[model samples]
Target: MIGANSVLTLAVNIGIAAISYVMTIRMIPRFREMFIKANLYGKDLCKKDEKVVPESLGVLIGCVFLVAMFFFIPIPFTFGDAASAEVATTGGRSEVFPYKEFVELIAALLSICCMILLGFADDVLDLRWRHKLLLPTIATLPLLMVYYVNYNSTTVIMPKFARMFVGNTLDIGIFYYVYMGMLAVFCTNAINILAGINGLEVGQSIVIAGSILLYNTCEFLLQHQLDAHLFSMYLMLPFLAVSLALWKYNRYPSQVFVGDTYCYFAGMTFAVVGILGHFSKTLILFFIPQILNFLYSIPQLFHFVPCPRHRLPKYDSNTDLLTISTVTFRAEELNFIGKQMVNIFRFLKLISWKDHADGRITTNNFTLINFVLVIFGPVHENIVTYMLLGLQVICSIVAFFIRYPLANLFYDT
Candidate 1:
């Protein structure tokens, strides 16, 4: 039995999503044209018949979402008609405006806007990996500070078994803040690294957002207190709508590249929801694929193996198939210890290598894209994109179930 206020909230959310969808769909073409005229185009590497496409069109998504949020978020109008202010009675107590919650929402929205700007800067400047990685840490500071100020509970409930050994809850204190900051950085960069092909960035984002929305809906229904999950849904639903609309031009045969703008914006939106809704742990569960991909690339990222600027799949113009891109390591580039590590990974088949006569060795770039190419052999670009997105969907579903029903077995849910 859902309440009237809940029903009204649902209706309002749907209306907002509808508006965002229509506006994004209509605005994409104009943004694409603007990007093209501005000479902000990048080569499409996934397709054999690739052409330069307008990039950084995520500006449209960011603008539309922010505008829609500001206009439609139902902030109370407390002008001269102060007595006409809406009120609701819960347990014989009258409730007015949720000032604190609304303020938190505003802070979160502002942080996301900052991330959008940071991402756009990366798009235009072609920032170094270190700069790109560190910038998001700065952009997310506002939201994290708000989280610290508003709700500073650093105590987490232990698992049922752990509770028996220790206590019901443990206070992590300031380490929690560091964890939250790392989570923000990881979320932003994880999606950034997983991108290359058409639609991959925005496509995985749609799947992740949809998964969160579904899980949040479940929590809202099952939990007696609805506010926390409702806050998450408010952000997630509109994000899904806008991303779906963006998917039109970002899909196979992509007309516009979303650039890093969409990735940072989308990732920050998820972080904002998790922080504000007090469910950051559950949010990480939904990012299983991104997490795995990040871990898989860490060695190359840290120079344990050679890394190229871009690890996009090799496109066979004649066969119209995508294959793994290889990275070559110079003999002088590795120490004895690093070569030993490389041999271990190669023997484990996590990587493959060919020693050349010119004192060089070539191995496949270690990324999820290359891994897919390895297992599936040469595949069409669209097929690879869809496969990756499908993998995301499956992983998110497993994560949702693990955090819900299966959670009861491990934790006192």
Candidate 2:
């Protein structure tokens, strides 16, 4: 059975999350006006009417999240543990300060704050892809430093197949930190790259956040490192709550755009919670869709194929369905090696392409959304969004299955 302090912590966290949700929902319409007056708006491309919508409203969400976190900071310490409670009750004449949790929490918040600024600046300044990609590395410095100083563990469990070859555990030392930094970069850019539809970004974030919550709740109930799970819960609950609020208006007929800020904020939230809560490995499992999307996009991401500024699905007005958007180049534009790679991928049925009489070749951009379109053909934008979100859920379920029943095949759980 859970104790009083644990129950109290739940109530307080839930309370703050709910309030933040309500605040975001209520403030969006008001913020929309300010955004429009400040010229922070963009025209919707997919729609025939080219509707105007407020942009960078995600900055508002990030600000509210930070404020809510400030209030949440004190509650965790007051109910953290016997030591924290004693220190709170006594004047600290002889009690030990709860330095570890305090520092970790502050560092996590600082890292998130930095990412928020990066995202906001990118939205305002239209930072180049190279610069935007590398900025996340700077934002993650605090998180890495905290991990190095507070709870550095460089060892990784060897898989069953490898255990016989190289024992049960292998220590890679500093490479682990490098891996975490890469994870932060991936987390920040994944949703941003995968976005185009109205609610797709926030919707996927909600699913991933909910998946993390489910796993953390299970771990909490099992009493497998309660403090860590609680920390995850505190970060995730508010994230899910605030995201749902945005989703209400950002769905099919979108009223506002989430922009780069929300994507970065959401990804950094997952990164921060996963790192601090000691479940970074498990956390990665929940991002299967994003991972697959990134892998499939390697060809286009590099100079192999000419990448466009916008890879979103084409909105066909004739049937009112979304179709795969393609990058077309003259047949001569592709060198022998690039053409060979394209032919190989086409033969493998990984992509679809068309040739025109004008001596040009066109192929779908490498993205999960386009991949689905290649399989299903044209469909409504909302239906496409649902299909991808459903895929995310399935991937998460597979992750849990692998983490639990199939554990013996992978590692010592």
Candidate 3:
């Protein structure tokens, strides 16, 4: 017979998969209707319309299914104060499951509501960005509550060389709240931005879930920490469920997109879990791609760089020379330069002077710099660990980028 734990996990997984299949079926027609009503069919706003569904309804149903799964799952067993007491008798210090879980769940629900309501409003009446920001900000209060209730007193800031050099002692009082609030806001926005492409945000969530699982497994091996492992297992369920469910429609030529609602909730859950596991550093490494994307786009968003212009350097077909006027550097410029360098390195021996002699652009090699970064960018405490991280990063980056061209080359009709 299967162990009780394994049985429960299997049951939960099957239940969620069943629910997701049902929800997807129920949602497709509604999605079609919404797309037709919005006049968004066969547009660049979305990739395809045959499978496209209404974002609001799909998100709402998905969230409900997720919440129900959480309640039904036996792992990360939710308990009352009495149950907490019982567990404490077994040497558990905390009588209750960490309050953070409940708080995060509620926060997720509220954020879902905000996104759905705003999306619906935008679809119907077209709400502006100001309202969109305001509504979500207001709805994020529950998240702030979680921050205050669970992490308010927690020490988030550590003393660094700057503090000692400046003769400033660390202030744990107000700083903690400020730090938590900032983290919450930043996570919410980062996830939102990362939601630009189908399956992109969900893929990032998978990376995080996998990392946490690894961390928990390591703790189990090193410290025999059953509780931590159990917690990680519990956390993995929702993420895994959502990822698989979303993937059903979000794979190549995606049918539906998990918009800000899903992305924000996923990000918040990741942040909370990372905080709980005390794996903030690991979390950062896992999410380095999204973080770098965010950092790179910030300047463009603020108009610090040229606006509404996406100019690529003009290449002379005959001379194979770049001839774009350069006044100031932009993010795209840096990216283009990097791409050129990588391409030049890749084809140094093959390309004849005649190729550039004609000033004609013959090849596009955008992934070369990305390849180098993935192969060498990972930093770790030990040489072995560093090598492992570098290899993992390279594999991941290669897999993600190669998917695009490979699909285009082989699958595109």
Candidate 4:
């Protein structure tokens, strides 16, 4: 049964979510103005003209989330039992200030804040892709340190097939930290890569956060579990609230841009929840679409195919439609190795390329957005966003089902 502290914790969690949402909604205009005044504007490449937009309003959401943390996180709460209540209340409120898990979560929050700053630096400096790749790894050090100090279980249960070959659990030892560090790097960059359209980054994040909220609720009610899920809800709810706020201005015909800051902030929230809440594997399942997109873009990313600075769809001012952005490269520019790779991609329908009479090869950029355009064939930007978000919802729902009911068929949860 739920106890008094649990009830209070729920009340605080729900209240803070509502408060954060309202705070973000009310403050968005102000933040946009601040961004404008600071000369932090970006050209919307999805438009034919260089449409300027106020950028990095995600700083508002990040700040609001951090400020909200200071209020509810330190309050003493427990999952179940009177002993937990004693641990919460018997000690003076002041004594509960330094609770271990709470400290860990706070550390995670600080790490995310640092990541947001790193993204802001990128927004200002326009860091190279190589530089951007390593910055998230640096930003995640504190989070990884806390995880190492608190819970260092590097053991992963072997799949049934793997178990057949080598029996039971496999301890990965030190590689586990490397795996987590890569997860942090991947989560941050994956969202950053699939971006360039209105609301795609924040929209997908909202869908993932909602899926996680549903999972946490299920664990709380169906499994009679708490703690970790409750902590997850604390992060997820605020993230959803703030992301929705950003989406308002970032949707079709956007008034402002969320910039990379939001991407890092959003991804790090997932990383923190997954790692600290002990559901990193399940959380990754929710990101299958992003992961698939990243995998699909690998050839272009490694320079076997040309990677553009902006992979946004071509914006036709006359039609006000976003179509595929085709890139052309001279045949000689692609060496024998690049030519063979392009042939493989074309056969897979992962790319559409043609050799012109002028000895230039033209092809659509390899990106989730461009791939969606290729499939649907030049729909409006809003329609494309809706379609992709629908796919994300479906993927997240299927992941949840796989982790829950189909556990025996898939492998143990």
Strongest candidate by lDDT:
2
| Candidate 2 lDDT by residue in tens digits, 1-413 | 55687679778999999999999999998899899999899987777787899998888998888888899998767775523533433664566557778888899889899989999999999999898779889999988998888879989888989988889899999999998898898998998988988899999999999999999888877778777888788888888888999999898888999999999999999999888888888888999999999888877787677789889999998888899999988867777767777888899898998889988888999899999999999989889999999999999999999777898567666
The TM-scores, one per candidate, come to 0.92, 0.95, 0.57, 0.92
Query: Whose TM-score is greatest here?
Result: 2
Candidate 4, residues 1-413, lDDT tens digits: the string is: 45666667667777887888888888888677678889998888777676889988776678888888777665533432222322445645522333556667778888888988888888888889998889888888888888888778899888777798777888899898887888888888888888888888889999989999998988888654477787788788778878887788889878888888889888888988888888888889999899989987876888877778777788878887889998888867877778888788889887777889988888999888889878778788888888889999999888977887777664665
Candidate lDDT scores, in order, read 0.83, 0.87, 0.48, 0.81
Worst 10 residues of 3 by lDDT: 364-373
lDDT of 3 by residue, 1-413 (tens): 22355445545655765665566556655565665576543322322233434453335444654665556544434332212423333365545454455455455555545555554554456455455446545555565676567556444333344454534344467755455445555555665554433355555566556666665665555564454355445556555655656666654445655555566556655655554445443455556555654554443344443323332223344443233211233224435544454345446531112233434433221121222223344222123223323544654455434433443453321
Q: Write the per-residue lDDT of candidate 1 for residues 356-390, one digit (tens) a residue.
A: 99988888888898888888889999999999999
Q: What would the TM-score be for candidate 2 when compared with the true structure? A: 0.95
Scanning candidate 2 in windows of ten residues, the lowest lDDT window is 80-89
Q: Arrange candidates by TM-score, highest first: which order?
A: 2, 1, 4, 3
Q: How many backbone clashes does every candidate have?
A: 0, 0, 17, 0
- Backbone clash pairs for candidate 2 read none
